[model samples]
Target: MANQTSSLRSRGMEMLIAYKNQPSVELRNRLVRLNAGLVRKIAHRVSHQCSEPYEDLEQIGYLGLIRAIERFNPVQGCAFSSFAVPYIRGEMLHFLRDRGTTVKIPRRWQDLQKEAQKCQGEMIRQLGRQPNDHEMAQALCVSVEEWREVKMANKNRMPLSLDATVCHQIDSSITLGDTLPDTYYQRMQLLEEDRQQLQRAMAQLEDKTRSAIEYVFFNGLSRKEVAERIGVSPMTVTRRIQRGIDQMVAFLQPQALQTEP
Candidate 1:
């Protein structure tokens, strides 16, 4: 087994040298085929106990493997597998961070986080102390409540460990999974009902108002984002949102009260 492994490595290195200079697509594909197992190995390692689809992880890992092939230096005194493993694993991790969440974050929240970090640093230097949300909001020319929402959204970007214990009972222990919002069937049922009710209410709204509500809430966009998407001013988007909410309440509230025990 060791002798076969050594021979394969030698052949791979020879192919690398030839391909680096001539750069044949055929040679590159051959290299990928030879080392495809490496990609799967790295993918499996990175995704251990993760719920992400194995095929998707492997595809991401293949991208990293290709990157490694393009950049590997024979003179770096490292084996090809050693050089490629990090790249493959890094790609998988990057994919998980960007796309693994059940609730997809809005791009606006990510942009807001960047702006908040920049403004927080500058304000701290100017004031010689950490600025509060109100100060930050005033500097950013946003409302304090809006600033708080942004901050909370940014804070939620950090992924929590599932294995973390949420509670300790007399005879057993409960993990964070046990307490997660997703674990509640009752809550999910209620949410589904609310979603159906909202959809029905939205169907009754004007086209423009419906679009505004969908953009702001369902699409996870800010009022400004909704305005830009719909080719309207932010103030107009806000009015539409308010009117939509009022209409939804009028349409759904009586039903909700009737269902109350």
Candidate 2:
């Protein structure tokens, strides 16, 4: 098993080098498949933290993997997996946010966050030690997952001020907002690129799957309504929409990656 793993790693590096030297559709596609295991591992980690399906997360992770492949610089002496992880996780986070995973946290969860912090401080004062998740959950009268969810929800709710200073030595005058794209042209270009990419991704989906997604997301139909329109069960329609999203992530390869000027 060790030998096989080493061989695969070596083969992946060789492929990366070849792709870097001369990018091609075949080479890029091979790299996507080669590093697919990495995507699954990340998806597993991310899926455990959220309510998203493992399969959908895995597919969304592929979109990040492809983006990483396009921007990777092997000469930088860093492992590709490490470079790709943030991209993979970022894609999953974006998907979650789009799906409304971080909407207004419930009142109970808000109270839970405050109470948990107080409880932790009290426990540490008494025990002179940090409490484990199970201990914290037990004290809070919530399950471990519930405790984690409350914390995550609270964290997501905290918004950073754009005017807050982020850098110290690199000109203290620079603020967080300064880092954002300010030019009208830049914003429009980015929006256009994103629009084109999304259109292309949707175009790549199966006709039935695309119709199901469009009816529900675009046409604002309920799952049952979409099902009736598509002549499929509501449950099947749900699966199709998820499957379509997964395919879109893979199909979201940027136009520049397809060919160079």
Best by TM-score: 2
The TM-score of candidate 2 is: 0.40
Give the Cα error of residue 130 in candidate 1, in Å. Answer: 50
TM-scores, all candidates, are 0.39, 0.40
Q: What lDDT score is found at residue 89 in candidate 2?
A: 90
lDDT of 1 by residue, 1-261 (tens): 999999999999998888877888899999999999999887787666465668999999989998999998787778989899989999998888787665555666656667778888888899999998889888878899988888777667567889888889999999987776765787889899988988899999999999998887788999988888889899999998899889989999899899999
lDDT of 1: 0.85
Following a full C-alpha superposition, what root-mean-square deviation does model 1 have from the true structure?
23.1
List candidate 1 segments past 4 Å from native.
Answer: 102-261
RMSD of each: 23.1, 24.3
Report lDDT (CA) for all predictions: 0.85, 0.87
Q: What is the lDDT of candidate 2?
A: 0.87
| Tens-place lDDT digits, model 2, residues 1-261 | 999989988898889888889999899999998898899998999877765689999999999999999889889988888899999999999998887533687768867877888889999998899988888899999999998898788778777789988876754577899888779978899899888888888998889999999998998999999887778899999999999998887676556577556
Q: What CA RMSD would candidate 2 show?
A: 24.3
On lDDT, the candidate that comes out on top is: 2
